[model samples]
Target chain A: MPLPKDETLIFFSKPDNALVKAICGRLIPGSPEDPGAVEAGAHQYIDHALAGYYHSQRTAYRRGLTAINAYSQSQYQKEFVELSNDQQDSVLTDMQKGTATGFESPKAPDFFNTLFQHVREGTFCDPAYHGNQNLVGWKMIGFDGAQVAHFDSHMQVGADQSERTPILTLADMEELNFPAPENGY
Target chain B: MSLPKVDVVIVGCGAAGGVMAKELSTNGMKVVALDRGDFLRTRDVAQLDELRWQTRGELQEPMIKDTQVRWRPDEKTDTIGLPFLMASGIGGSTRHYTTQHWRMLPHHFKQYSENVARYGASAIPVGTGLVDWPMTYEDLAPFYDKVDEEIGISGKAGNINGTIQAGGNPFEGPRSKEYPMPPLLQSTVSRLAKPVLESLGYNPFPGPSSIATENYKGRPACTYCSFCTSYYCFIGSKGSTNVTVLPVGISSGNLEIRPNVRVIKINKDSGGGETTGVSYIDATGKEQEQPASLVILSSYTYENIRLLLYSDINKNGMVGKYFMDHHYPFVWGYFDDTVTNPSTGPWAANVAIDNFNGDNFDHTGLGFIEGGVLEALGGDLQAIAGAGVGSWAVPMPDDTPSFGEGYKQALKKYFRRIASFISQVPSLPYDANYCDLDPVVKDQIGMPVLRITYNAYENEIKACAFMQNKAENILKEMGVAKMKKAGLFTPPTTTHEVGGVRMGTDPTKSVLNKYLQSWELPNLFVVGGAVFPTYFGYNPTHTIEALAYWSADYIKTQCKPGGSLTQYF
Candidate 1:
């Protein structure tokens, strides 16, 4: 249920769009044996949020992405997505520490915090929001999602309920006759 | 447009307003209660969407459409936007509250006199506007019992007529009887913490909750859905005003609830000595006048302050001074063997150790004058909320990576293994921590927003550190492998914000009288936590309800058909 290409391209340009994907991948880069933000469709989630819930932050994203590119070019003489993994991490580290130059208005640390929070939300939120595809994020964190009832037996002290049952989501709740939200507020 | 005059017109039909509407209408007084938000049906809360209700605050007043408040830690710094943690609809914050209803200890009401007597007058902090409440706990106890019975609060009474009871909060103020309902079932975290607290000789008891444990008043018991905090209960188990008081008020046939209207000002006489009615804008942007013989302001703390300031009703310049909130600090424990099951029960303090709260323990040499309650809580297991450092139950430690494979592994490992103890510390009022109209910000309707100037004082910070140490000790005694102390020095977070239009015996130092009546304007009665003289360790909802009932009774007897207000004064 990822956003269509036409809708995804509305929030960011092609180059900045690829840069978001690259940043999310580095923030939660999973191994070949495990799932991460990339597998959870965090980039698509960010795109969806930018077009809706986080629409007010569009200006900050644009300014922050441009400043990040400028800082990358000055440091590595290349675009952020084109840099090596280590180089990209270094540039992001600078931004996180608020030491990256050329960032104004939104500032570097503020932008980093915003992007970090969005990436986390995209990774962990219910898949009905078009993220957490296949419940990868939930599996990664051992979170048994959306148990409407029957948690008493599993939630006992010293109980190992982690491997007790199959995980559920908001989508499953709809099928199980449990009330789910019809629309976002 | 002009509406027909009623006997009483109450603005903001939430906790206090709900009680007022019920009492006045049932007593045969025609009442009109206006609320800015809709009276949501139970179906509206049937869905369990943590992302929508908890994280995004869908049930709360939207900052974009509502008045967005501003805040700065200190007066010298530039103010930043802060969310007013209040709900707007029929129930106000009571709709989405955790329902951790608690009656304030007797010592809380007499903090000023008690501290002065114990440690002498010079022990009082220089800038702290510490004062005894106009009324005592004894004066409000009957009303407290009334609210507990009417709202069906569940708890074991600790003190009954000065006799200490077993397996209950022994430090509690004397009560005539037990709670209306039994306490909610204990969670795994509470079970684990009980032995540890008892070993330390701290009296551990079940926290009083407004959520029903058994069928009461035709409403079903709590389902223990874990969506208890920050989300409405679909089963009508939580004793919110919408489910309990408002319905009774409407059933009386004398109460008229007008929703989706904003009261802009409390209209007064030409001489500005008494309130005549109120001017408001309807949902369709039409200005209307709702004239009444008596006007009661029962909105949240911020709104009560804002309306008073907006109406230019600060005759003694004490309209929005001494704003306070319980400066909450959390201590978390990571146990490898124990499954704390942080997402199980009513999502409130299930078990609390009251030995350290209020004046229960001596504050003799402790630099601070007040202390706070320590408790084991549950149901903050939402994923997105737990990902952040300061916002989570088991937050990422300083050494842990912000994200990556390591972060994912840590989250999985500690998801059910982490338990936290939150310290609900008492906050004394300070002259510097006050609220005024923001010069730069305005609401969606072009009204100036409230700007809060507050910071953690030395007393509060020291109390927080002391409580954190105590929490850490308890966690260690519980055999926690790893522990982290999180003492927050941020903006006012606890929803127990109090003391804006504070009540006092002296008119020069207060806005409301002992009966919560406006000193300058006799017909205007202000209710809610806004009239609290000081913030206590416990939640303010029960106290607020009791005060509202007390004020309603005062209005019932003193302002009835032949009763005279002059006689009371």
Candidate 2:
């Protein structure tokens, strides 16, 4: 009953998904060569998070996505995701600077901050929610992933150390090898 | 229905609650210890996974639907989802915290008096509510040793009875005992920092940690799992109460623990003017009243004050008055010439510099009365969420900026080559910064949840700026390239949450007395960091534990007799 998986995304529809991808592209822009939030399963993770750990997190996400769309219509007369990358950047920059207004918004500062925070969180959080797939985040940063201990050859320090003693380190997962570009989805 | 009565009703099972339970129960006084969270074992926690807890803040308090509160200048609850952060459940915040324990330096006790003597009182910040604790370091020293030994601290004692060590806190007051375990493994980052620190004439010591270096008592040694701060110890290795005290207390037969029982109020007998018992909601949503002769508010600082305020337990309504937290800021740099695996160790770093802590520095022209230590924490990249792996603090492919084709090159070149250092500064209590019931918001139980009011003082800001400079200097000495000093350090956070029901000699100015006795009702006691009259320049758990043991001894010896209130010892 405590929900099977860790994160279940709540408020995202198909359009909302496109908006999150666009916003995340701006926040933690992924190049074509390197897997970005979209390819890293950020959209899927967001969907799961809304359904999982924070169900109410969806309400805020919905409010934010709706506001971005409404603001886009008034500013550039286009949907948020449909705008040119530069145009989208301009809108985000305005929002970040607290210059944007209207759209039943809870102040531009809070809106931008909440939106930006969620996107970043969705993209960079543990891949268990479906984001950072194939250990994209772990491998890119040389994160070893969660291991039982630091008991590997790397942990062989000064003698008098025991063999059965575990050196479980969160930073040294054996499977967290850096991804080859060709192998990525 | 008739319920069993006991001598003391201690709420929570964390550092303070555990100490009170052990001390009071072992003293042969019957105790009914209640915790509003589930019981967690050390082995149960040691099985944590990053995908489950760490990145998601899962180990932290669950997000109460629309229960989040915020404090802007106007005291607003208008914002729908403001991050009103506070960890709840049995051990409260301590259950999922990195146990980086450090005893407060001697001068932290008498900050106001000493600073006023050294520098004019005018040097104190206008807005800050800084004050000297009613008790002194000497008063708390013996208890510090007792708690350190009982709970098991790990570090080399820098100063023992006037003898200074080659490394360790030379500024520390005389200690009667040594740590239970040796210091943890110093990482490559700390190794590189040593010569640079010595070259610059500053001593860097392996920080005092509750993480065991050797198997002590029943708990195992730290596995260096690197999932410390946000994750529970999967191996039962860390010195959290689940591993150290709770089990011991449970086996004693004198101690009775009831987890998942939410304390609604400290039920006071209106006629007798003494605390009769507490009314709590159990996990099954049934209300029950547990009676006791004495009550100790051992919950975290916020809950300790909030429960008292909600129950109106204190006569003068001084609960939730002096909320304080350590204002931590960061200064990070990128280094090119090293194999710095920033993410392959415990959450704690090895090097700590206490040179600027408390009144260690001359306050001649300084705006702040108190100062704080500057240190570096070695971090790891277990997930992409925390992955900023380059010279320019570049985020992962989708974690930060991937502007153009050139940006791709930047990520590959700099991801593993960069390391960062952070600064931890002391935060003093302030008059404008306090907590009270919000006029608008209410919790699930319909009690008005606490409303926090805080803004950084000029002195705190100045202190942060100073600590930043010191950290940058250390980074520079360590041969870091592009050591960027983070600017502004805006919107002081609620991480180190301290003082609310502040302890003082006068009942009018303080909620609890020097012995942690409530001024209105002598039988009632409030322990934990909430009773701290002033904020010291370190993590508050160690001091809170020492104070709990000290106060428990007083309760057993003198206070239980029902005699005069003015007696000391």
Candidate 3:
């Protein structure tokens, strides 16, 4: 369910998208054995969410991204994306602990928490939402996406099931469909 | 628009309303059941998208202005998080319920008397509004069986007409008949805990659930689809009233179900001694009057109290008093060697032990009066939650850092190897915990929203902690590598919302009578969990369904012309 790569950005600007990618990389670092948020295309997922289900968070994302960059500039005279891996962790820790400066409205902690939540959602959500690219999230952790029934074989699972078998989504099942105008955020 | 009058106008056609609708309509009385949501068919609930259904509380009562429920820890504090538990569909919360159908034990009906009889007069907690039920378990036992057949329950009866049956909850009240359907397959959680439970000399039987194991009344059997709770049944297997009694009421040709209709005012006679009917907003959003001889309020607990309070029917300032809810303390752990694959069966496919619940064990010197049923849970699988998306219930192993590589590695390790257990303990109704209208907040429809002032008390906290210890003991015996006991007792958040419009014999002390009939107005009846004076440790749906059938019989046989139904009548 990966979106076509050639498609234009729906919500994020090129710079914002790059910033989100860097943040996603730090939130969950990508690895060969177990791909994390960056490898799962969580930035794209957040962008798509900002365009649709989470349009209200647009200002928060904008200001929060700006604040992260501003704080990075102030602390190290560089953009957040240019920070070293260890430096990036320290910056994010400050943001998570509400210690990072110049963040308002969604303060440092609020922005960091919201960003982390969206990152997790993007990393682990159904690929029908256009995240979890190649079902890497489902594969890294053994989650059978959408099973019609759970038999004894499912309970006997020792390794990641998504790695061994095909993962099901809403598109795979004729019975399931997204009922929209999803309220109650 | 003025609609045609009916014999009964039932507000909130859900768990109790469905049964009442089926019963009264079948008895040849015309019934109109109005709800604020759609009559979603089985096909409407096919999807299991975790983000929408679980995290968003999609099937829950939508957080519109009119459907708002505000909460605070106490009267002085500001309202905190919005507590959304009830649903709006034809089946209400029954649609998304885990279907753990359990009949309250015999002693649960006599909470006050049993404690006094066993441990003298001081056993009852101070300021607790504990009282003996005006009606007995035997009185509702027949109706409980009727509910068993009506909703197609799957269970093994522990006690049948005073004789104890093997493999069933031995502490349960005597039942007149066996369940209509047999129990589902024991889950991996159940299988893992079965020998351990027996070694501890506890009776381990598969819990009773409305889910059918064999096709009955044309509903299919459960598929172990994992989307059982917090999601509706797509295949008509779960005995949601939409597939059960509600259809019977419709097919009987005497029931008229109006969805998306909000009942605003339970109309009363000018004298304030009789119910005329109800004034409501129709499906098209026009205010209308539907006059009837009787009005039944089955709109869950909060709204039931809200409507009565708004209608100025607070007889003893008791309409919104004595609100209570069940205390659910969850205990879970991660295993190193075993992959318990906690994601296979529905929640009902687990075993239940009543040795700790109700008056089964000695509560003589304990800090609490009553205990709860502790069960090793099964198939409480949520992909988003298990994957660590939602903050409500992220399944990271105990002591693992919540972020970075340690978080990812811990979640991956425990995703398939976790074991979870829970206990459902009933919180005693205290004088301080109650529901009233929110003066500051109003719904879009110009009605005052329900403001609940509740706090988890010592009795509930102690009971929950005790059960958490017991569950941890069982998990430790099962040999878990790492374990976590959830912080205990946050009230009015979890489901099992009961009380508020309590039933008692003394008209001065309670809102409704034993038969769920309004004490002041003979023609007005309030059904559902709102009438539970105090809930037992069991899930309240079984009792709610039983009371509906019990009241429906009274409405049919005695609550009519010339049978001393009421002096006014």
Candidate lDDT values, in order: 0.81, 0.67, 0.82
Each model's backbone clash number: 0, 38, 0
- For every model shown, what is its TM-score relative to the native structure? 0.94, 0.84, 0.94
Residues B1-569, model 3: lDDT tens digits = 56877788999988899899999999888889989888888766677677767756677745342577888888779995475756787888788888989998889999999888998887777888999888998899989989999888999999888899988888888888788888987777778888988998888888999988877777877777676777887577788887888877887899998888888888888898898899988878789999988898998888899999998888688888888887778888888867765556787888889899988999866878888788777675765677665424545765887578777887778887778888888888889889998988888877888988888888888899889888988989988888887778756767778899999999999989999999888889999998988878888898899999999898887756776543433
Checking candidate 1 for backbone clashes, the offending pairs are none
TM-score of chain B taken alone, every candidate: 0.97, 0.92, 0.97
- Candidate 3 residue pairs that clash: none
For model 1, state the Cα shift of residue B74 in Å: 4.0
Docking class of 2: incorrect
Candidate 3 fnat reads 0.37
- Model 3 chain A weakest 10-residue run by lDDT: A176-185
What interface RMSD does every candidate have?
5.6, 12.9, 7.0
What digit string (tens of lDDT, one per residue) describes model 2 on residues B1-569?
43788778898778889888888888776788888666765434444365455555554444233245555532443423245344555555566677778888888888888888888778776766667888888999999988778777888888888788877888888887677788887655676677777788777888887877777775667767566765666655566665576666666778888877888888777674678778888779888888888888887666777788777766676677767777666676666555555555675646777888888778677666677776666643444335431111234322334332244344444554455555566566777778777777787778776677766667778888888887778877777766655553434344567788888877788898888988877778888888887887777789988999889888887744565532321
Measured over all alpha carbons after superposition, the RMSD of each candidate to the real structure, in angstroms, is 3.3, 7.1, 3.6
Stretches of model 2 off by over 4 angstroms after superposition: A1-33, A57-127, A151-185, B62-69, B73-84, B120-131, B316-318, B337-339, B384-418, B486-492, B559-569
DockQ of 1: 0.33
